[model samples]
Target: MNISLKFKQVLNASLLKPLLASFFKPYCLLCVAYEGGELGLCKACLSDLPWHSAPQCPQCGLLSNGLICGSCLNLPPHFDATYSLFSYDFPLDSLMQHYKYRNMLPLASAFASLFHSYKLNGHAGIANIDLIIPMPMHRDRLKVRGFNQALELARLISKSTNINLDYSTCQRVKFTPPQASLPLKERIKNIRGAFSCQQNLHGKNIAIIDDVMTSGASLNELAKTLKEAGAAHVECWVIARTLAKSNY
Candidate 1:
């Protein structure tokens, strides 16, 4: 690239960016009400969010648990705790689908804002996070998706909380099928041995960040892997949690 072209690129980003953003109004992805700011949910929608701020059980965010879902009770997840901002449903699910599959990168900022609020409200087990780890995307999957949605959200959360993020320390070694597409029984097998965490996390509190939690097979596997690597505790912080077996 020519020096002049580089200069023009910088100039456009610095000057034209604000001008362009100002030209268009922001609106909620749900109601299309003008208020989402850089994110996609207006104030009304924001307040009305099915806030799953903290789960009674530090394990699964699934509602069937009714204070500590049966899954967690019967077979506790390796992760010590889990928390989410909203229950996965309607417009939120659609918005997340679009954000994840349809390449809506800007929506990450809105999701990150909710995580910031979670911290402010003092969600359980998030008290002292030694490290922030976004659920990793396999290298092949990364090329197809263009970016890791979890990592994008985690980047902002890491910035807000000033916690260290170690994406390189953990990796998705296998390109497993999407858990949502698989039967509940197959979900665990799909991701087994799929992650490799390089660091020795003994006594470290690791927050596994992700866009949503459905069956939680992925987070569970990640937590199990982290445990193998000596992580003292692994907690998951997700944008939404699916209550039903069906992908909401």
Candidate 2:
């Protein structure tokens, strides 16, 4: 086997072994308090989490109870639908920053569990998805980070839902300015035409996975690219949504 495949096999074996997990419990990256349980965070932290309970815009995934948020209703996104697990605030935002920027990879799995635990109620229509595609990073950024947070979350999600995870099906051709550093309009411009599909996605229903959604520009661009590549439908699955300033 190739070196990369061998490493992946070792990592998978380590992740699957309960005894190995126990031995590394105290050092677990996501475990706020390793009390010998499998859950990374203590029950208290889990219970007090600021989960996304408000209804959201069916298009952009912004928190809203109405048919759609004003922003989305006025201007629809390329993606057909969006869903998120938590609101981007306080402890959740802090945790996400750590996971995304600080290389706390274990937190991805914890966030995935949060996404898996969410019940769609009667919205089963939105939950039945075919494939999970994480937003791809430019080659340069991927080299620096060693892993994509979105891909890590997607892996956990795939394990939970038994869904297909296609990491290399989409490629990011541009190494544009970081979306967080740019204005909303600039962010959209930066990501436009940045993504392309390498494999056939014709007639496939794809769910774009991401660590968080701020302006929704990246997801919109990706969805548009997928649609152009003959994807029948595109949905977004995100870990957190940045609430509007008025709601805060």
Candidate 3:
């Protein structure tokens, strides 16, 4: 099946499955209100969450009023573009914390559904995407965390988009400390040479899905590795983008 047709099927399924599930189990994740339609949030709560609608740089996802930000112009990232669904803020941050640290696994479905909805609205070059890759976690971190949140998300997204998902070709070789815990200035250095791609990806347009993008150091390094392995273009498809300048 083609990308467009697969997207339509996923869209239809996303809409219908949520409505049906809501009827059977109705409680919002945020307010405990009845009939939490999608993502387990009532319509009111969902609307109030910080959705990323503002204009931003296509490369790094930082605010730039819809144009390529000067940051990207000055120091271009390895990734060609970024498509983020939410601003990392307030309850959204709390939600991500719960999902990542507290093991709220069901939120993966919520996140993937939101991502699907965003893609359905249309992107100029999405159809050209040749593969989906969830950011890799080193074996040590995987043993500690018990799961790679990025992989959980990519699994659902790949199923919906019919895009080839490649999880094994790339591996995180360095077991560096979490980027979020490090100082911004040190993050890039800490993540450098952390990724290794075993397979050649010549001329492929690849998308990397992650739960959040803070300094983007990890993504940048991963993109660099992919480019070295001959990927033609790399796109970061993150669920949330930290809007704070400090995070960048």
Candidate 4:
């Protein structure tokens, strides 16, 4: 064997194989240990996750079984309806953080599976969607992250649903600060006019896919933009939703 090829084989046996083996083994992200699946979360951790299965607002996807949550009923959101796979809490929140800020791409597939498992119930199926638009990230943020987590999730969803993915249709017009750092009121202002539909969406039932929904401000703003651009309906599909804080 050539010297270079022999050295390459040695490196793979001594370093690469062991490293990859450790990586593939299911180690829980919350608590370090073998989980059982590629999710890196054990069955117990998965079961303990705060899944949102309660009654939800038909419009904004808030957890209220009635026709709408108080916030949505009084002042309707721009999006016609919203749905999420899980609550933004506990281990799931941690998982999202890793995926978004930490650039953990593998976790995106796990999240997609959760979204797929969500019972549509009376909700519209992917067949009803004319286009799947992922919430866009500013150029600066996109450059730094290399990839948008929402887009990653959307790709997986499209593969499963066979819906048309339209990444270039909706574009981010401005670079804004992270929404989590801003106050609730500021979030709306920050994202206003931030997104614009580049392609005609007339009579199209669009579905906006996002990784998280905190105050629903960003989604509302994007939906409003699509509506003005001639979209017939705008629905939201998110991976998680931050629970509302109780008033004292």
Candidate 5:
């Protein structure tokens, strides 16, 4: 008997959801409301979250009304485009902090579902995408965190969108200081030589999945590594973006 992928996913979700709910009833983490929907957020709180509202530069993905940024014009990053789903602010930042630092692993599904909504609402550039690569956490960091949040997100996205994920073909070779902690001038240097790509992805367009895009230093470095490994196009699909020009 042959089973379809969608049917299997639905069956798995149907089976596991009840078992999960039996242990802990679903509730919104932000408001303690019993109104958590499919995305683990109530409609009110979900709408209130800082969604990215400004028009963005096609090349850099920064809010600039489609104008190319100077960085893209003068020294273009290896990535072809960046897609940030929400603005990094307020409760969103708090939620992200809790998810990454407080071990809120279940929130990955919420983030991925939110991205799917964005895609459905006419941001379906995902069709042009060929592969998904989550930003790698170095062995030391992975051991410390016990999980790579990006990879967790990539799994959900791959399942939802059916995009092929290549997690084993790249690695975080150098564990550098967190980009959020460094100044913009120092951020690039910190992430330099941090990633090593092993895949021979000639002519394929891939997106690196991450939770937040702050300075973009890490993503740019990873894109550089991927391009060197022969990926035709590299893009980013981040949950949030810090709109200001300063490093987060």
Candidate 6:
């Protein structure tokens, strides 16, 4: 690329883009009555969203008053910790459904922004991560979806944090029914032996990105695979976590 062209691209991204965006205010995705910010949500709507601020178990991201919950204590998941930004409810649930099923692509950027900013506050361990892996989808499912929502979110996060993102290193080998469709007892079995890691992640601390965590069976299985490949640590970083008895 020409030097001048490179400079122009940077200039547009750093200045011109924001300037143009400022002039054309976008309507809030939720209320639609107010002008939206970069998150596609107005201040009131954004503030009203269910943030996961309650004291909880750091392992499974479920509500727990103390350190590790009883479930994690009894049968620990392969992942060391979990960090979820929102409680999967109401408007958030609707927004996620739109993003994943309806292909609301811009929501990827909005979600990535949420994750990045949340981490920036005090997640010092994020800097220790060697790789960012988006929850891998089976090739068949990827084909039908046209794009992987997790991969899209991870791409923006990788760019912002300058972390190496590896989508290909781990893959969902078993093409099974959607975990959402299955019963709780069937979820772990459905996800069992689903992932395969191509590279040896020896001593690598990894963060896996996903849009929603329901049963957590999928993330647990993936973390197990990464640990088997010698990953030093694995953590789940999801946009939302279902709080009900439905899944995890």
Instruction: Give one digit per residue, the lDDT tens place, for model 1 in 1-248.
Output: 99999978886896687556545866566774656555567778877777775434556766543476666767788888777788888768888999999988878987898778764367644567899999999999899989999999999999988889889999999988888899877988888999998878898999999999998889999999999999898888899888764221
Which 10-residue window in model 1 sums to the lowest lDDT? 57-66
- In model 3, the number of clashes is 0
Can you write out model 4's per-residue Cα lDDT over 1-248, one digit (the tens) per residue? Answer: 99999988886886587556666675666665556476556788778888877877767767676577777766877788888878898778887888898888878887787678664433556578888889988889999989999999999988877789999988999899998899877887888899978777899998899999998888888999999999999999999988774110
Residue ranges of candidate 2 with Cα displaced over 4 Å:
1-36, 119-123, 126-128, 245-248
Candidate 3 overall lDDT versus native = 0.89
Write the residue-wise lDDT of candidate 2 on 200-228 in tens digits. Answer: 77898888899888888888889989988
Residue-by-residue lDDT tens digits, candidate 3, 1-248: 99999977876796687666666897787786775676777889888889998888888889887888888887888899999999999899999999999887888998899888875357878789999999999999899889999999999999998899999999999889889888987998899899999998999999999999998989999999999999999999999999876234
Residue 21 local lDDT, model 5: 71
RMSD of candidate 2 to the truth, in angstroms, is 8.4
lDDT of the structure predicted as candidate 6: 0.88
Model 2 C-alpha lDDT versus the unseen true structure: 0.79
| Most accurate candidate by lDDT | 3
Higher lDDT: candidate 1 or 3? 3
Instruction: State TM-scores per candidate.
Output: 0.83, 0.82, 0.88, 0.86, 0.86, 0.88
TM-score result, candidate 6: 0.88
Residue 196 Cα positional deviation in candidate 6, in Å, after optimal superposition: 0.6
Which model, 3 or 4, shows the larger TM-score? Answer: 3
Candidate 6: where are CA atoms >4 Å away? 1-24, 245-248
Model 6 Cα shift for residue 91 (angstroms): 0.9
Name the runs in model 1 displaced over 4 angstroms.
Answer: 1-22, 38-40, 53-56, 64-66, 245-248
